[model samples]
Target: MNKTINDPNSPHSIAAEFGVLGSMLIEEEIAGEVIQLLNKSCFLVPANQVIFEVMTHLYDNNKPLDVIVLQEELRSRGLLDQIGGSEYLFSLVEGVPSAGNVEHYAHVVRDKSILRQLMAAADEIGTLTRSGNMDTEELLDRAEQLIYEVTQKKAVNEPEHIYNLLLNIFADIENSNHSPGLSSGFPDLDNLLSGLKGSTLNILAARPSMGKTSFALNIADNVGVRQSEGVLIFSIEMSKDQLARNMVCARARISPHKLSYGVDEKEYKILTTDASVFAQAPIFIDDTPAISIREIQAKARRFKTKNDIKLIIIDYLQLIEGPKEKKENRQQEISFISRKLKEVARELDIPIIALSQLNRSVDARDDHRPRMSDLRESGALEQDADSILFLYRDEYYNKETTEPGISEVIVAKNRTGPTGSVKLRFIKEYMKFMGISYQKPT
Candidate 1:
């Protein structure tokens, strides 16, 4: 039904609707582009709506478009005379300045249409509230979901040719070394897995005090500082300050105890000067403990849009909570949480590194090495992770071991490449990981 102009609050623009139709008539190529953005109900003028409906029909059925074709079609459907004959259609093509702005004009019409829908939604919600029948929470959820649908409507993608796909693949292959996807800060690791491919869930697992959190923080700092990329760190176990102190220890090569407990003048000077590196780095920390997956997903999405965040690091997976309503089993809940994290990675098109804990079975073994089965909630984490890295430090088990400071990142599961171990030096005092080849000053 056409909205009467007497109602002042009805959201509609007659000029924008006419502009979109006129531009489409003037240029045939842009017809599809503008048509995809709007529909029949987007117009305030009923005649404009009828003209657009007929124009879309002509374009859809392979008919060559012109004023004559449109008039004949409207005449055949008995709408030409009702729409004020060919005179109104002639005026439709007169005022459009450029066909290039058709899509923009269409967007204006669509936005007005959305505003009208919001008005109707508000009325419905008011009616529901007056009746007092629906649950308050359910009503709020439905209202939010309705508004979200309006924002999500967008132009759909057409099929891409194979040549385009080949170009992207070749480009990625050529740029795999240093500037590929978000850098791992390790040349060897970047070469191994192409610097943490986008839309992947990377699991860094180990027993307690194995430096998984430190390793993730180090990677975050590397990407944030070196690449100047936005990084969001969700620290469930450690506070934001603890994370920053640990980061300082790793980046500055200072002792964690001194940075944490107290700092002397010389050490304080070093910490303050070195800490400036992080001041400019685009790193955001959220230290909410036992947060649910839903909340994390919401925050990650908002951050991705606001900051254009390139990487997300959850300190450890075990500390996260599932939905408010408890599930039947703890393992199932853990599986749900990990899967949700994977969705966040894919939706934002970024790499998400989630820390995990290993079962004590690895400690019972004489070798004291962890594997895929040692994942605390075994089945789901292994299944959902695109890559699994098990951290093992020989010094943690045997003090007089052959390689005292070397930590092994056992690539147990890699969807993109070969599975093996990458050696890095883990400094216990600083809570830092360095390349195995890095030498200390004796």
Candidate 2:
């Protein structure tokens, strides 16, 4: 448990700092652990911070860490006399004879550092609020982000032993259903991609009229309704009501056009039944148009904490607003957005499916199928995504083609698995995609 301290200035413990420095000098092996646990800013005492900085420099260069070497390095940098010379170094070693309690001492210093950071962050928020220059909601979001970053700074940097990791893996295998990731609700697609793995950024790209939005909604409904897992959808291109209507029509197998005339008793029952299921499903939708990446990050973090969302789907990457910092070109802006989206997926520890638009170059191609090169605006989308799926319908290009009412999901790139295409039946009237052999029930 962390204790809240009101006084940031008085949070320093001189003895703890000395103990950490002393342990590092006593045992060279302890230096590495100390370096990983705490950095210079963790030491409130100026001399201790200087000493630890020099010690890190020596450790990085594979030099010996002791009084003699440290003194020489400090002297060369003209910080020796300022930090109280050789006596201070000797005193630190004499104060702590053993390195056994070094880790404990390090924790105390780290806790103090966190309290100070929190206090400083509070001060910053107070100043910003007083200035009254920014919008209220934006200021509040920034304030929360500042505090979040400060708290996240305490994450441990220790490396785990391979043996421990293997033990965990073995246990997972024994208790597992052989499905390491969430199912996409399509068996063949699941077999091809091994389901949607967590901590991954998946790119779903296609030209207009390829049913990209419908395909994604199908997966979202499958995961959220069928599997009873939380799903979050950021629909940048469509309204929440619009997405809901499409999903209801797809799941109930009713043509959306028929809704204009009115449905028969059976059709109305199916529609109401499916709508009820959706109402109870743990699916969250945010249709904030022209939303920037920062806003998405903020909202995604909030939803993950509150809902424990297992899947996140962003409707069309091209529609998402880029970073606040102005880029040299549109490609650079897109590259930055792609990298940040990948980071968001890793940070949230969930799979993110970002819909994307393909370049017109695909239309010029004889096959009318999208390649990785056809990703619009930037190649970073290809580089950052763990997997890329292209939606291609033969009937869209040629009405009399033999594969009418069928669509090919081209697995253009799979980072951890084999690449292949999966054919699905596209019910154009209802805006739904199902397995190739699926038949609508009477």
What would the TM-scores of all predictions be?
0.75, 0.71
lDDT of 1 by residue, 1-442 (tens): 1232213469878788888988988888888887767877777677887998899889977797777899999999999999999898888788887788887789898888877766766666677778887766546645654444345543224565687689888997797645457779887787777787789999999998888998999899888998899999999999999888889877878888875478788888888887998889999999998876776877777787678899999978988888544466889899889898997888678999999888888999998888788999879998999999999989889989999889999998989888888999888778888889887656
Cα lDDT of all candidates, in order? Answer: 0.82, 0.87
Worst 10 residues of 2 by lDDT: 1-10
Question: For candidate 2, lDDT tens digit of each residue in 1-442?
Answer: 1222334355778889999999999888888888888988788777887999899889977899988889899999999988898899889888897999999999999988887778777878888999998776568767877676576765533566687689888998899975788899888888888899999999999999999999999999999999999999999989998898899999998998888799999999999999999877999999998988878888887887778899999997877887555455788888988998998898778999999998898888798988888888758988999999999999998989999889999999999899999999999889999888877666
Local error of candidate 2 at residue 41 (angstroms): 14
Candidate 1 structure, TM-score to reference: 0.75
Once superposed on the true structure, which residue ranges of model 2 sit more than 4 Å away at CA? 1-142, 146-157, 440-442
